[model samples]
Target: PPGFVSLVGAGPGDAGLLTRRGAERLRTADVVLYDALVDPAVLALAPSAHRFHVGKRAGRPSVSQRAIERLLVRAARAGKRVVRLKCGDPFVFGRGGEEALALAAAGVPFEVVPGVSSAVAAPALAGIPVTHRGTSAAFAVVAGHAEASYGPVLDGLAPGTLSLVVLMGVGERAGIAARLRARGWAAETPAALVLGASGELVHTWRGRLADLPGLALPPDRTHLPGTLVVGAVAALSLRSPHSTEAQPAARADARPT
Candidate 1:
């Protein structure tokens, strides 16, 4: 009998944010191929499962997508209950669709368990709502890695018209800011970079669009996974009461309009 495969979202590096269904899948998995960003606590739940680190981090030698798909198929064909776990929502730039397509072509049965995407969740956890009654009615989530591809998209949208959320953008912060400015986005538009959102080490840097390129560089210069939030919504922050980090104190550098 062919075994089943489950593509599960790990959710922005926070084990607590993981959905019950995702956890159940992990616990029962005969083998789990998980990403680097998955919280260790979550992985602990599947102690008995054979685990493989198939994560691809920026600026690092990592597993190729093709290899990962092959591993998934091979394991499932061996009648193992395989779980391909990823950070954030599987379909949101997580390459989950690609894997699913590969499995289908290989005649493998699979299921997808959705997890909260960092695009909206990160901003919300940092107290910035992607949509507000009067401030914003629509929001755009874009990948930050390819500025050229998204240039036309950004050019068409009027500045301050809606909220913009960028995932995996910390590496291209400068280029992203320059592109937005060239596209007529206001220099004073509020922008924020949230690191480790929904996790214990959460940190936020708030400023204006023009300042984003500089603010993106944290003191440590560690290439931490982050989400970039832009627009009026970025100016609003309501830190969760449960957050260990205190409320964002006024920053002399923040050019909030």
Candidate 2:
């Protein structure tokens, strides 16, 4: 008999956010290859499966994507049920498409189980809505890992008409802010940095677009992935102050009057 593979989304750091179908795949997995940031609770779901860590991080030694694809195919050919667990939606900058193509070329049987992407969930959990009536009717999610990924977004999208959600952008935020400023965005435009959403590490920093580069994550939060929110919607917070989630921190110079 042949084996199977499941490309499952682990959501954005919270086990509770895993979809029902995703959970089912894990429960029956024979071998699991997971990302660096997947929540431990989610991995615990595949208690009976053999676990392997193949996550990649900036400035760290990690497995190559091609190696991961090869591993998936090899494991399946060996008659094992393989699960490639990734953080956030498999197709959202997670290199899931590449893996799927590899599986197809190798003639491996596989399925993709989509989960919540941090691009929207992070900002939403931090009280910033990407879209709201009478505010922003449109939004764009951009990958900030490289200059090419975000350069065009800043050049093309007018700051007033759209909300911009940037993932993996914390490292290049200063450059992003400079580009926005040069693009004629108001110095006081609302901006925010949302980190560790849907988990205890969650925290939000809200401030003016000019002050975005100065909003630093604390030492405990430096390793966590972040989402950058810019435009009018970044100013709105639906989460109540009494809510269980961490409160948003406003920059000293950009605090509300």
Clashes of each: 1, 0
* Candidate 1 lDDT score at position 257: 32
Per-residue lDDT tens digits for candidate 2, residues 148-252, read 878987898776679989999989999899988998899999999987777667778889999987777788998889899999999998855344434443211
Residue pair clashes in candidate 1: 127-238
Q: Pick the candidate with the highest lDDT.
A: 2
lDDT of each: 0.85, 0.87
Error of 2 at 255 (Å): 27
TM-score of 1: 0.91
Candidate 1 local lDDT, 155-222, one digit each (tens): 77788889999898787889889988988898999999888776555688899999987763656534
- Which residue runs does candidate 1 get wrong by more than 4 Å? 240-257
